[model samples]
Target: MMKFKFFLLQALLSSSLACAGVMGDKPETETPNRLFFAGLGGSYNSVKLDQYFNPLIGTTNIYNGGTLVAFGTANGPAVPFHTTQTTFAPEAQLGYLQSFSNQDWLWGIKLAYNYLSITMTDSDLVSPQLGTLTAVTGAGTGFTGRATISSIQTRIEHEFDLMGIIQHSFKNIHAYLGLGPTTFGTRTNIYNVTGFADIDGTHVDVSGTPVNFASTKWVWGGVVELGMTYFFNPTWFLDINYRYALSPHNKTNYTSAFAGTLANGYTKSGTLFGTTNQYITVQGLTFTINKVFDFV
Candidate 1:
């Protein structure tokens, strides 16, 4: 996906350069007022390292009250959920515009909806994994163990962006830029997680139960955009846009189950879980046919 986005960006640049060469030094186009525009485009998005993140379980303190080994916090190698995802997203936009000054500087705001989805599986193995648990007075002090982790974590991002727009025109062409805050109506699912611990120890379990890892409410981010439109007439145009958005997730939430057996045949089962975050950034290129209704 990285290679693909890079190539597509190169192509867009080439096309823009070619257009510039052909349209060389043409007189600037007339400015219009009271305009409404709508557009639809397709984009490709790929994600890399998170700005802020936590593994599924991050506690590793192995001693409880200075006596017992807290097995859950004994994690060594954390789960690798940093897998990359490539998404071909579809987006739609609506905006209203007018000339902001005699200089033909146009100012407006745009609202857009984008579908950015991701899904992946990750695993980790922690041997001699040990943690902090309440000491059962008579359970004996030598609590040591190993654990393995497996899970399928999914992220589906539905984004709505409201950006302020500014644009200037060249003969038969308009170049524009937009900036704004973005909101994510995202959903995450964590399923099929499993773990194994020491024979004489209890393992932490969260995968046995399916849970929603991310919520659909209140994930905020930001975006910057640059685009060009080639006017075929007064009301119709073909546009190509490049957008970059940064989404920083605050935290993750989920419920987990803990169940394991001791070498002495006693059964142990209870609770343990933690929060995490996967902040993602994406760059996209899109092409759309747009229509403008002008009131000049």
Candidate 2:
């Protein structure tokens, strides 16, 4: 889905750029037409994560047979409460831009490294049962398998972008657009994981737990950006732009971690994987000061 979205976005951006190229086209050329440019900027970003759980966990449609409470409505997978921390991070970008076909028209590539993440779903959660994974249990006879998950910290990513660029220069103002592939080092963390299964009259804590767990991986995605730069002189400029980035649609199969011990003689242990697609999208506005040096 994310890939499809990116392709669609690419198509739209291409169409718009093509039309603009034809409508206000000019034969623009300059001395020392090739340049290497570098800049520092800040990107304010928002990340959104979506994952709906499998109605039935594992092979069982019923957990505790409606006798005890689960995480959701009639014993769900997890709880409703969640938290999202937003960050405004700095980005470092360096790239080469040069005129192609015309002096006013240019094509180049920009490479950037930055970090961001999306805020989780809004307040009211239709399904609080999402992200419910645990180690299976042993030792004690089961009564009602219940769990209290203190928190599931969301995902964070270090994103690298390699964008193909196109621009049109008019007087002192230059408008540009870019679209290309991206890569990420992503991490997901879960904390305070504890569960219970009522045996007889006692609620025993399900052990072999992942009290604090984290997993990391590499992912691929895409980004589309549009911006304009104001030239202070021929070699210096100030740029402000908006960028929209989409991460790949990925899967979750727990942290592959089951630690700690069970208080009850019979232990509980197992892992949970959601039955939904999880992805991230980022929208940012960046401001930068840049300098371009004439090269070959």
Candidate 3:
């Protein structure tokens, strides 16, 4: 009876050792196989501007032997213009990721593109005799103008997995932060004039010749992004991101025929021509869906 008990104990010990060896020899589990991801998303942007309006001259209005005019108190009828605009922006991205044992932890690099358009218009009408436009030695006058600008940008991003939560039977969710540099290009067009001047029931045509102006500028800056992503499976996910620029926005200078010749000529004549610097800064939020195609 004693021998039989000892033999049973030895067989159980042998079985345990064999099971441990098999487990130790097995390779680590492979990560998800999806690696390449492409997505399209829309973004909303907040753009702010600093604008400069140079001295403008009208053919029919003369003051002090110069077509250019400035009104003190009683500068008769003048129009005021204000504009508001909204844009629909689109984005696309591609990236590669590495995952650790914790599926929530990841590191990756992304390249993205964005396209946006911005438009603005000015509209206001007041009698030239009001306190605003009293200088013209007559009853006051009324005008309208519009301008549009568009741009496309490409950015390279580097991401760090910040934190996440996962359930045994549910999709994985992760939050991350990214930062990188961006390159952008823009085109601007202006379509505007001081409008027709109506003096005491007589319509004076004061439309300056239409001007065509354009410029291209390159901008470089740092960008910061915060995002949340959910994995439908190990290979597919959706992400929502918000990005902010860390550097100053830069724009190309545009020269108008009137501004260059007339304004410069005034300066040469020892008169003051008002010119202000105008620029816009970009800030945005985006949402996208990404699929990872990992081969390793």
Order of the predicted models by lDDT, top scorer first: 1, 2, 3
Task: Identify the leading candidate in terms of lDDT.
Answer: 1
lDDT for predicted candidate 1 compared with the true structure: 0.62
RMSD of 1: 12.1
Error of 1 at 23 (Å): 12
Collision count for each candidate, in order: 6, 26, 26
- Arrange candidates by TM-score, descending: 1, 2, 3
Model 2: per-residue Cα lDDT over 5-42, one tens digit each: 99999999999999998876853323246888888878
RMSD (Å) per prediction? 12.1, 15.8, 12.7
Candidate closest to the true structure, highest TM-score: 1
Where in model 2 is the C-alpha error above 4 Å?
A: 1-32, 51-76, 79-86, 115-144, 155-157, 198-204, 208-210, 255-277
Worst 10 residues of 1 by lDDT: 51-60
Tens digits of lDDT, candidate 1, 140-250: 333344434334354556778799999886756879999999876655554433433333444434223332333455578899999888877768778788888777765
TM-score of each: 0.70, 0.64, 0.48
How well does candidate 1 match the true structure in TM-score terms?
0.70
Tens-digit lDDT track of model 3 for 1-296: 99999999999999999999999896543336235667778777665443334322232223444644533221222232223344557777877666556654666667767675554433332223222223445644433322211211222121111222221212366677777776545444433433234445554333334444444445566667777777766666777877765335443433343222222242101111112233445567888877677675
lDDT of 1 at 80: 39
